[model samples]
Target: MEIRWLEAFVAVAEELHFGRAAARLRLAQSPLSQTIRKLEKELGTTLFDRSTRSVALTPAGHAFLPHAHRVFEELELGRQATRATAGVVYGTVSIGFSGALNHLTLPPLTRAVRQRYPEVQLSLTGRVMTGDGVEQLEQGGLDIAFVGLPIDPSPVRTRLIGREPLGAALPIDHPLARESAIDLADLADEGFITTPAAAGSALQELATQACVKAGFRPRVVQEITDPYMILTLVSAGVGVALMSSGVAGIMPSSATFVPLRGEPTYMDHALAWLDDNPSPVLKAVLALAEEVLPTPER
Candidate 1:
């Protein structure tokens, strides 16, 4: 039966008097009695025993009362849930970050999101290579990504969040590590450990360009994907590699990070997302990024 029919049935069942039930429902007596009669006919059972002066529930009316009350209860709960969800930002937002950049970026951004938009769930994917992050964003898998640059402009939009000085990761016992800052030329004769150029590591280009500018081509002995592994290889004296100064925060003790001397070199970290991304939560996140992330220093 219809919900209004059930409402009428419940009101009449409770009041046990047609006039009183109509008054409680804010309906006129004739319409209220007609609604109850229609409900009983739809259910194929008599719901009330009525006389000129009194009205009382039949056995079937007693049996249906509790179930009818439960239906209304469920409808109320559904309304409450809808209202609550409408007032808050509630959805899952997948965020991707390259492993190398997480130490410098993810924690602060995550903290700010948790504080400001707790209703928005964060699905974090770590070790997402810069290129992979962009691809994920374009494919609708990632809502936002913190990635490295040398990123060619595409359908995805990017905003520079931070720029860090490029530094050399050297073995603790390496002669260059003794200096406060080491020039790129100081490592001219050193074999280098680096991520593959095809892996879309922005530092790979920076390293190659800086070395060429320093008048030497690096002899890359090991090509790795993970920055931590690159550090491990350098610690074992595999070779020197260029990395952001922030790497020092998570670098293993076996390696030392020394700022590169001479003309300054920088690596950019940016927030990238599909230009057409339609998530309202993504918009909220970008606004928060503006507030929480440091402005990129040229």
Candidate 2:
């Protein structure tokens, strides 16, 4: 079918609302509805189940969505290849990074890319948790991402970039805060603060797993997304938190970070990208990342 038809289909599929999809595409609602109908007829299958109340994708639509995204990705790749033939490496590489990498890794990597490829543009989105970054990479929204490790290995390729011990954040006046290193079992009865489970935080998983191995389940008192907020809550004596030792640099004055003893717990950091992505610009960036920021040895 026509490219416009696929565009209309993707917009409606993502928005799931005829009016909003039409507005997003800058088309009249009536025409947008007609376009969907035409696309459905051409494909010989219904894509969405619609009612006055809501819109939902049919099974066929679910299966077709990823392919639809691939079409646009391929088109962009072709355009980049054409530019490359003219001796110019140019394209926007969208990158997503979690807050953990904000202090050390991301800044250097970004500067290297800009300096090496002046014509290439880097689109950066920060505070993107691990789970969201993976979803964005799968959907073609991000070309590369710095994500937490111990993730599923399929669909995406990853390389270890950094590793650091996991530690505890406690109120400065807390009894355990005076110790050189604290054991997970020592804090078993203490209320804990952590990132949301739904956000797919590997750090959260690691902390929970460590506590489980220590014999008792941690009683979570609060869930937060920001590292600063988590530390702030800890400083207020809301609860203790398990965090990367790197966070010690930014630790609030009222809070203290102590290494986990008994068991050496650590958080692994990695760079991830889709294996099937054909963007030449992405390839260039990945190469630059390798040279500028070499993967740390395990």
Candidate 3:
């Protein structure tokens, strides 16, 4: 029998009266009764016992009630899942990023995405949001990412999200920290802690550019992977490092932050996604990113 027949049967069984069942199902009594009879004939069992004055369930009706409710529940659940996928309200997206994401716009962006699309889980990978991360996004391994600019930009589309002022991380007692704004020339003689060559090039590029702008090449004393480690090295007076102001939150106690001069060599933060043909979910994420960032003129 058709699902309509099963539905009519369920309503009639629940209400135990032809008129009330029809009212609940938004149908007329005669049609509802006929539909129930058809279902009973197909199943070869009567679903209800009716008299001129009373109505009751047959043993078969009791057994079929739960099954009918379950079928409808499962069907509705399947429909809801489909709608959520279409709207990107529910799905898992793989994301890749560097260890120092908390140093830029990424923190609030991820937080906003989580708060709004609670069902769209992000499966994060990679310590640096760079080459491999961009490649994975093109390969369908990642959906969207927060990364440094000046990437190869071969297969991925990127939007410049925001720019934050770069800061100098120096020992609290370091003489350069006394400057109103730390000039790159001031750090020229100071040893610098840098990021790994293979992981993230953003930090390395920032240091190099800042020093060149200041008329000297920075002295790289050591390269470390973790931001906190870089801070610890500075705290121990190994050298100073340059990065966005957001890095201030995770700095070691011995290190103090000082502003960078002449635009601070602000790191460009971009959101990267597949360029050839982005998915609906990716489109939604890009739109969300745009909303979070302000317009160019503003």
Candidate 4:
């Protein structure tokens, strides 16, 4: 039977009133009735029990209803996929972003996409670290990602989009907090609060390793992943933290941010996607990012 016949059948089964179903489908009642009749004849079964006053689904119709719904759903999904592949102005692009990059990058990127590709949908997944973002991009869960660098750029193509220097976050009352700048070596005696290595905190790893290179190992008192929470721990006087400079703007009032002295240390942010990914929406998003953010010199 034709798909339209199935549509008519399902609509009628739901509404249980021919006039209402016909009105809902924007079809004349007589033609809708004819389509249902044709569908029932093709199946060699009576689908609906009709009276002068009302209509109800027969046992056969009840069993067929679910299958009809599935057919329509699958067909519609296929249509949308085909349209998206054809570069139609539709479909969704899922983006994964690290927490540190969220405040600086996500809002403007989302607004640009919505403005340029109004019909395309944007799905944002935040707080994903570089390692998880890389995994998600490979598994097709994310179309693109803004990740902290020191990532293995192999297999997935990545481009540097932004950079922020690593800085010290200290309790406001700490003696060292009075310094406009603090060297990593000077903080050796203090406990450190940082993200876990397994959480793929490239910046934290870099900071800790730098401390090690400076003739002292960090005594980490807290291992947390969320950027703001790390700052909160610092503010509570738990330990000093090495965090991105951007945190200075939103860090807790009890915490003070100081530039790291003696080296131009920085955390690089990059946009990454599977090299084999052939999404046109991804292409459009990259173009927008190029225009909005300053790309690192190759």
Model 1 sits at a Cα RMSD from the real structure of: 16.6
Global Cα lDDT for candidate 2: 0.88
Candidate 4: give the clashing pairs: none
Residues 175-290, model 4: lDDT tens digits: 98989887788988999988877877677777877788778989988988777788899999999988778778887899999888876677888888886766656777788888
Location of the lowest summed lDDT over 10 successive residues in candidate 3: 276-285
**Count: clashes, candidate 2:** 0
lDDT of 2 by residue, 1-298 (tens): 9889999999999999999999999999999999999999999999999999999999999998888988987887788899999978889999998775356778888899888889998898877778878889998789998888978666988888889888899999999898998778999889999988898888889889889989989999999887678889999999999988888888889999998887577788889999888889999899989987788887
Could you report the Cα RMSD, in angstroms, for every candidate shown?
Answer: 16.6, 3.7, 15.3, 8.9
TM-score of 1: 0.69
Among all candidates shown, the one with the greatest lDDT: 2
Off by over 4 Å in 2: 8-67, 118-141, 153-155, 178-180, 197-200, 212-216, 261-263
- Window of ten residues with lowest summed lDDT in model 1: 76-85
Task: Give the candidate number with the greatest TM-score.
Answer: 2
Question: What does candidate 4 score on TM?
Answer: 0.70
Q: Candidate 2: TM-score?
A: 0.78
Residue-level error in angstroms, candidate 1, position 296: 3.0
The predicted structure with the larger TM-score, 1 or 4, is: 4
Each model's TM-score? 0.69, 0.78, 0.65, 0.70
Candidate 4 residues lying further than 4 Å off, grouped into runs, are 1-88
For model 1, residues 187-297, the per-residue Cα lDDT tens digits are: 889999987777677778888888999999999999987778898898888888888888987777878999988887788888888866656667778889899896766
